[model samples]
Structure formats: C-alpha cells, structure tokens
Target: MITGVYSMTLCDIGNTSFHFLENEHQFKVSVEDTIEHLNLKEPIYYISVNKDGEKKLLRKFPNAINIEDKIVLKSNYATTLGVDRALGCYGYSDAIIVDFGSAITVDIIAHNNHLGGFILPGVEKLKEIYPNISQKLTFDYIEKINLHTIPTTTNEAISYAINAMIVEPIKINYQRYNLPLIITGEHGKKFLNYFNNVFYEPNLIFKNMKLLLEMEK
Candidate 1:
C-alpha cells in the first residue's frame, strides 16, 4: 500500500495531453508542451499510451515512474489491449466501461475479469471524416442529438450518424451483458443522454492506479 496517498503524484499520458493528479489537485497539459516547463519536483507514478510523450517525460523527469507493468489484472483481452482501458475496468466486477478520449474504447468487466472490448474513432476524429468525404458535409459540433429522429439537414445528418455509430453498438452490448454502464474520459459526459443506470467517472483511471499501486506491494 502507498505510504502517503495524499502526497502521491500520478500522471496519465495520452495522445493529446498529460493529465496530472497531485494531492487532491488535478490538471492537464498538452502533449505538445515542453515537459521541463511543468517544473515538477515529486516522484510521479504514471501510465502512458503515448510513446513519444512517455519518452520525453522519462528523459526530462527522472522522478517520473512508469507503472504500466505494475498493473496486475486478469484479462481475457489480447495482450495488445491498452493499459488505460484495462485500468478503467480494474475495480469493477460487472460493468461496461466506455472511455471517450482521442479514441472511444468500450471494455467489459465481468466477475472481475476483462472480457475484451471494441474501439472506434472518437468524436473529434469522426468529425473529420465527413469533411474529407465532401466539404459540403462540414458542420459545427452538436452537443446533443436525437437518434430516434430522422435527420433532415446536413448538420443533423452528420450528428445523427456519428451518435448512432458510437451509441448503437454499446447499447447492443449493454443489453447483452445487462451491466451498469461506466462512462469516463474527456468526452465521456457527453454520452450520458443515451443510457440508464450509467455512471460518469472522470477519475476512474486514477482511482484504479492507486489500487494497482497497493496491489504491487
């Protein structure tokens, strides 16, 4: 177990940003920013999916500890599963964890075992696809969409398709597993409209990181 939980600094490096939790304070910095600029002075326990960012962090901050290998969980998922997704499902016995970051990952944990999951392009990434297809398809981001309604306008059509693509599959799995939905990551809250018995946990990964640290000892 951690000797001083309150003083522990945890960092989660993603493709787009570096998320830091120090004490009870949480903040983020862009991956493009210089690592030395943070002026961090504590021993940091971190997990990262961004190879470039991880390298820079380790090179710049000798105090930064890479704890990806320390996370011990029984998963039926292939060896290639992302650590973020694995940790997201760590403490849950039965749940569908949908993480919306640079990519959307849906992982299932049943009876404390990971049953594998699927991935899709995230909101921002999906938005870029239509414009590539045709400039006329370009539209402003829509925060809310009605999947039941047939879209009439170009913008509504794009929004409907995006929401349908992301939500429909998860809804199918939710019905199959009959598990509580756990939503997390940067864009996770935007999906609250589509499900019942759902939870929004922005700090799910960080919470599990602490659990993993304890288990490591």
Candidate 2:
C-alpha cells in the first residue's frame, strides 16, 4: 500500500481537543490520543493554546511550525492575549469572534484595534460546575434540547441557563461593539439564532494558517 503524503494538514491544539484538518477531512480527538493516531511524519502546521500540549506536539512533529509564532497582531492589550484569539481576529479590520471550545471566548477587534473580550466556562464545563454545586442539579437528565426563553422543567432550565450563560455575553458585546460577528470553535455554529448578522466559520484557524503559509512563501 502506498502512503499518501497529506498536504495542508492543520491542527488547532486546544485544552480540550486537537482538531486536525487535511484538505477537507477533519478529525477531532483528545490531546492524549492525538499523537498515536495522527499521520504527521511529513511537514504539518499547527496552533496551540495549551503550552504543555504544544510542547508534546512539537516533540512528536518537529517539522510543523507553531502557526502562532508567525502572527503579528496589529493591536495591543494590558495583559497578554491568547494566540488562538489572535488568529480568530486576524485579517479582519472589525469583527467579533466567539470561540466556543473548552472555554468560550468573545474576541473583539474593531477598526484594527484588538479590544479584548469576555471568557467563561463552556456549556459542558458549566454543566459540570452545576453538579459540583449541588448533586441534585446534575445534567444527567438533560438532553441536547433547543433553548427556550421561558424554561418549564428542571432539565430545560439547566439547558437554557447553560446556553444563555455562554451566548448572552457574546450577544451583549456584539450589540455594544456593533461590528461583524464571526463565530468559530466547537459549538460556534449553534449560536446562529443569537445574532442578526453572524457568520459561522469553523475553518477560521485553518484559514489563518493558510494565510500564514502564503506569507512565508
């Protein structure tokens, strides 16, 4: 059997998952299991938010560039911002990017200014937190139900609360900034109803990666 060399393989390494993309094929797995199954002997490109995970990925695939290193932000902040946030806002003059991953982040860039954003636990983490606060508040009974404005049952209440807690801040910031909204990450697409003019681009990181590669060449 001939082993095919994958081109433009992009990995967005995050705290909770490693999203691997090759052309149109996409795979997501936990960080611990990624190295074993990933076909990365050849050159690849990646972006990592977890420092330790990045180190491990580098040890496994030395040829790959940490795409974050190639990025040059046009704006400044008091504290350091995350590279993933930078990439999401890259190439956009004015926009809001809501990344719904392990941690939900609402990154804002308006008029080429990196205004920073809000961060909160993702819906899964939020659900985990509820059970810790009270065992009776467990989400074991909850299914992936569409959020309702006025929830009637316990499960509905928890579901709505979880979704609202994540989306409300993004909605508020979008209204406040009045800029274009670009949603990405795991749960990014499910937020379409929250905004009037929002776009779901799951490939924002990969698009940024490709741009970086083109700049290098």
Top TM-score model: 1
Task: Give the alpha carbon lDDT tens digit for every residue of 1-217 in model 1.
Answer: 3365446789999989999988788999899988786766477899999998898888888778888777766898779998888788887889999999999999988898889899989988898899899889889767698888898888889999998999999999999999999999988888898988899998998999988877667
Residue pairs whose backbone atoms clash in candidate 2: none
TM-score to true structure, per model? 0.93, 0.86
Please list the C-alpha lDDT of all candidates, in the order they appear: 0.87, 0.78
Report the number of the highest-lDDT candidate: 1
Tell me how many clashing residue pairs each candidate has.
0, 0
RMSD of 1: 1.8
After superposition on all CA atoms, what RMSD does each candidate show versus the true structure?
Answer: 1.8, 4.1
The 10 consecutive residues of candidate 1 with the worst lDDT sum are 1-10
